[model samples]
Target: MSRFVDIRIDPAIVRRAARGDARAHEIIYRAFSAPVYSIGLRFTRVPAHAEDLTQETFVEVMRSIGSFRGEAPLGSWIRRIAISKALMLLRSAWQSRGQQLDEGWEDFTPQRGQDGNAAPDATIDLDSALAQLPPVGRTVVWLHDVEGFTHREIAALMGKTESFSKSQLSRAYQRLRPMLQVDEEELADSKTTAGTVLGSC
Candidate 1:
């Protein structure tokens, strides 16, 4: 008979990690790496930058562990760190490329349907849609949709007014709408062609 190992939740693990116990550090690192990595990827399109952000996130988490008072789950704490680090990396990259922070996307209002749902024919290849967005737009969409942050919260996180954050999100949707529509049409055409070929045979 095979034996099942029982896993336990221990506050001591966190404490030990804060105290620099290598084994405890490993345990914490493994537990939160995926969530951090996924969050980082949402912020950065490049794989190498995302991976580096993930590692840097963990380092920050480890360094701050001693100050954690257990107000929120460790996973959430780590995620916050990851988001902050990814944004920092993005800002640095933007500065290096000599891009101005003020993009005029705010003037572009998204066309919303009557029921307030995305258009039925609209489809977006998630990665491509996101990649085409400006940094502020991409961050707003990812933070709101993927990470489940409210516009108000996102505003606070990004150090922008709520109106600005809302604008950013709206512009992101507007920019993506056309691309999504095109994707849907292509998919429909492909499906129709495939069906016709099958029926003729």
Candidate 2:
């Protein structure tokens, strides 16, 4: 799961939610919505899909609350559901489109404003950079880097060998390297410009 979620919920709240308490349901929704939506967007890069995933994830959470065994942290379990939902949509996309990799992410690269700071197109965010890779590669990177899923786990999720996960991650990094280099150079330029301005002042 992303660091954006703080997963520490009172177990009593789970009990209440399981008992069909509306307030408890709302509590769980508020706590988990951001991370769920974030995961959706990171995976699909589409606002509508992310919104739908968020809604669907909550519905699943409510329906399954009774069986949640507390063997894992609530957040971890919720994240698993969100990832599964996102993958299902992606799988459908793959089947429909013949695994067409979205090149739209190419529209976004590192751009800077005149103020020597990140411009409207600033591309330092991993999500933006990640858009450069193929869908499976993107999924592998996000799950590993942000969500902390091991390669073996990711491979199982994708129904591939562990080496396939490793290879995708490797390929993703390769594709992202030049963009990251540009980002680094831009940061260096920004700092140098700032220093020059300060010295003149």
Candidate 3:
């Protein structure tokens, strides 16, 4: 499991939510909506699809809240739900298009030192660069780096082999390296900002 910044939600609210209290549900939504939507957007890159995923995630959370044992923070639980829903949507989309999970690796072969045609600016926005990657490449990178899922976990989630996850992540880094050439300070700043924003929820 990924380690998230510890942001405490009152146990009483979770208890109320498990009991099907509508007001408690509303509170939970407000607390988690931003991070959930952000994850959806990162995965789908479509505002409408992200919206749908966010809504679906909350619905599932509400339905399953009674099983939550307070073993982890509420936000972490909600995040797992959001990731599952987003992956389901992606799988459905791929299947509808007759695309196999491992069908397109040839297209993603790294152009050695390719900069993704990034601008000459000294700094690049990580999120913007990520948005430009192929969907599978972007997803694997996000799951492994941002979400801290091990390659085995990511493989299980995507219904693929661990080697596939490793390869995809390698290709993703090859694609991303040139577009996001930040210094250590800049990298730390981005991580801090993301953590703060997500933790705020």
Candidate 4:
């Protein structure tokens, strides 16, 4: 018998999907497609590869859903699948056809401090700057800042040292900060000017 599931039954849906329930499987797929795609892109940095990972990830997820114990959030479960898919692709590329990666993006260390508390207006939208980082640096920063993983966890996941994770975060910030050349004082001044103009008008 096929079981219909709402988002509330995420765990049940996962279980049933693992057992091949078509309806529950659809719910699971729709729930995690965007995050799987976005994270796949982050890992692979190729749009086409990301698309493939998204599909492959869902397939893997469905295959393994019954084993999911709900120990972590559903999203985390799906993310693990996506990361695994991307890494598998990387491995296959290396083994089958040999792949070359630029080494210049490595050996980066952040010149900035690790204190999360930068001054007011300190948080810069450095998405573009992040794109310029070496893929490893960007991955470290995204996993740390965006995904909220600890250095130890990231090191474990990437097979690097905690110090390497810290250094990558630093390098990513240094490369990013220059792109956000505006100072806190400048941002404050602009805000004040805008406020004054709006107040007068």
Candidate 3 whole-model C-alpha lDDT, 0 to 1:
0.73
Better of 2 and 3 by lDDT: 3
Pairwise lDDT winner, candidates 1 and 3: 3
lDDT tens digits, residue span 57-114, model 1:
8888889999988786666677778878887787677778776444735444444457
Clash count list over all predictions: 0, 0, 0, 2
- Pairwise lDDT winner, candidates 3 and 4: 3
1-201 per-residue lDDT for model 4 (tens digits): 001111244466667787799998888777767667777776677889889889998878877777888886777767766766775665466446444322435444333435543333334444544555666666666666655568998777766689988887766555655455554454234233222322122
Global CA lDDT of candidate 4, please? 0.61
Model 3, runs deviating above 4 Å: 1-5, 104-117, 181-201
Error of 2 at 143 (Å): 0.6
lDDT of model 1 at residue 33?
A: 71
The residue-by-residue lDDT of candidate 3 on 1-201, one tens digit each, is 233335567889999999999999998888888788988888899999999999999999999999999887787788888988888998888788898765555555433234555565423355656666677877887777667678998998888899999998767665656655654454434254333332233
Among these predictions, the greatest TM-score belongs to 3
- Rank by TM-score (best first): 3, 2, 1, 4
Candidate 1 lands at a TM-score of 0.73
Clash list (residue pairs), candidate 4? 110-170, 110-171
**Local distance difference test scores for all models:** 0.66, 0.71, 0.73, 0.61
At residue 122, give the lDDT of candidate 1: 41
